[model samples]
Target: MRDIALLAILLWIIFEAFRRPWIGILGWTWVSIMNPHQLSWALRTMPFAAAIGGATLLGVLVTRGRRDYSQSREGVVLILFMMWISITLPFSMVYDDSFELWKRVMKIDVMILLALVLLHSKRHVMLLAWVLVISIGFYGIKGGAFTIATGGSYRVWGPENTYIEGNNEVALAVVMVIPLMRFLQLQMQAKWGKLLLTMCMVLMASAALGSHSRGALLAIAAMTLVMWWRGKNKFVTAVGMVVVAGALLSLMPAEWWERMNTIKTYQQDDSALGRINAWWMAWNLAKANFFGGGFMIWVPQTFAIYAPDPLDVHAAHSIYFMVLGEQGFVGLILFVTLFTMTWFTAGSLRRQGARQPETKWLSELGGMLQVCLAGYAVGGAFLSLSYWDLPYNLMILAVLGRRWLDRKEWLKEKPEPVIALPAWLRNWFRKKPRPQALP
Candidate 1:
């Protein structure tokens, strides 16, 4: 039954793609982030994502209209980064493995470019955000509830056979979604809506802690601090953060505390020590090979030459180190430049959007994206999420928001009605006569 339902939704998305390609893009994002197919028994083996990608491309070609592509330095840097990785492929320590990973990365990057072109409208941006929040927040909400029920005894994991399947990866993903949830909550006018989002935020935070990830601990702290800094009311934000942190920490077991305390004494922790060895290997490899060792450089053969402790071979646990190992110094430079420009661009949107009521949501969104990026930056240092789609998508969102503000698209758009009502109801209100004043 679950498989049938998921398959039905997949077919509907493909059918809709021809008329509205942006829906396909949103569908692709939902599938990728949520891994809904992974939850189903039969549909798990289907090529749902590939099918959606093909449909979206066909939709783009079939749809009749002038479409715009992003022409920003950020986009240029991303493309350059893509080209650099391809350049390093021939020099890859393991050619077959690296080429396979290259294909996957290219697919992700191509969709990102397509998204930038198609998702330029305000409505598209909002829909994309909704998809991201709902998809990732599903885990966050479930994990939070699970934590509460289990008293944070068991660790929360992401969907099987996905990037965030590991405890640490899902924790970082959850922490990043918190600010997006907050941004959505702020857009709500109804009291119940606000309360619901607020609840989700707290639950998501609890879920992050419940993962018992020390990296997530640092990420949540960094994310919270940045969110507070970006907030309109600093004092209230600070107080709220403190209260939430205090309450969540209280729920954690003593074993969780013991695990986290190892951060300060990383030398004695084998896992921490192993990560350091991997970082050294990355540093040594980059220094010798200008283009680095390319992808799949984690093998014992490559580590034998570059790693300080060759026998202690491990994956590049840090995003910085992973890129440094796979793509070399130039790739790392491009990677850093891409996100650095995006960070400032988001800040620019936040400042400019604050000046008007119509664009106030942009201000809130920009601030939250920055918070998300901060979490990724800090948390990514301990996790190998170098090619994660979420961060790049957030960058595209920032670019789109900036484009809208710069072109003043709101000026051309019809003002959204304060209250949408049925025609009959509106006509009745219009025709109804007012009572005479008592003279």
Candidate 2:
């Protein structure tokens, strides 16, 4: 029944995706982030993501939507990066692994293209962010509740069989979601909306703590500082952060603290040493294979051939090293270029949009996104989520923001709204001087 239901939904999305590709994108994102079908006993084996993505592409083509990409540095660099990857795929040392990874990347790249083509205005961009926040925010809410219920004894994980399957990934993802949620919180008008979003932030923070991942701990700390600095009410935000963070830290057992303290004593930690070994292995592989050994190149065979200590093999826990090992020096550079360009693109949008009263919302959103990007940049160092969709989506959002403003000619002489100053101030200089003299 679950299989049938999910299949029916996919069919509907295929039929609807052409007329409304945005809906298809939402459906894909929901599946990708929420992993709802992972819960379905009967539908667990289905290739739903690929099928929906394939249908979405066909729909996009059939509908003949606009495809004019921005001439921004981000757009050009992304294309160059993809072109480079295509050139290197066939030459991969791990042929089978590379081919599989190539197929996966093709799907991801198409999602990015859709973002570039389909999103025309600020509404579309906001909608994309909303979907992302809601999808991941579900786990955050659940994990938060779990943390409270368990007294922070057990770790909070994401839904089963997804990218955020482990406690560490869940924590990183939740940390990233924090700022996006704040973006939504600010845009909301009502008192209740503010309260609810505030609660979500608190719960999500607790969820991150519950994960007991030291990397997550570091990520939350860094992300919290940025959000606090960017926040309007600095004192209130600071106090809330200190209280919540302090409370969460107090709840952790001695073991968790001991584990986290290992960061200072990393030289003595075996797992830390293992990651160092993997990093060295990646360096050696990149040195040998100019084009890279290929995706998932951290296998024992490669480790045996490349690692300084073949017996202490581990996953390239760092995104930088993973890309270097899989795609080589050129790939690493392209990947870094894409990230750096996107960061600047978003930063530029925030600055430009902030100057316009009408576009201040975009600026606010951009600030929140920058915070998320920072979390990913830092947290991702200890994790292997180098190709996740969130960053790419954000990059495209920044790109779309610039294009949207350009199309509207927003920079040219924008009229500011009339101020509603106090009546006393308006009359203060005119007649108040005479009244004061008479008194």
Q: Top lDDT: which candidate number?
A: 1
The worst-scoring run of ten residues by lDDT in candidate 1 lies at: 413-422
Checking candidate 2 for backbone clashes, the offending pairs are none
How well does each candidate superpose onto the true structure, as a TM-score? 0.94, 0.88
Candidate 2 has a TM-score of 0.88
Tens digit of per-residue lDDT, candidate 2, span 11-66? 78666776667667767776777677787787877777777777777877778765
Error of 2 at 289 (Å): 2.1
The residue ranges of model 1 lying beyond 4 angstroms of the native Cα positions read 415-439
**Candidate 1's residue-wise lDDT over 74-174, tens digit each?**
98999999999999999999999999999988999999988988877787777788888999899999999999889899999989999899999999999
190, model 2: CA deviation in Å?
Answer: 1.4
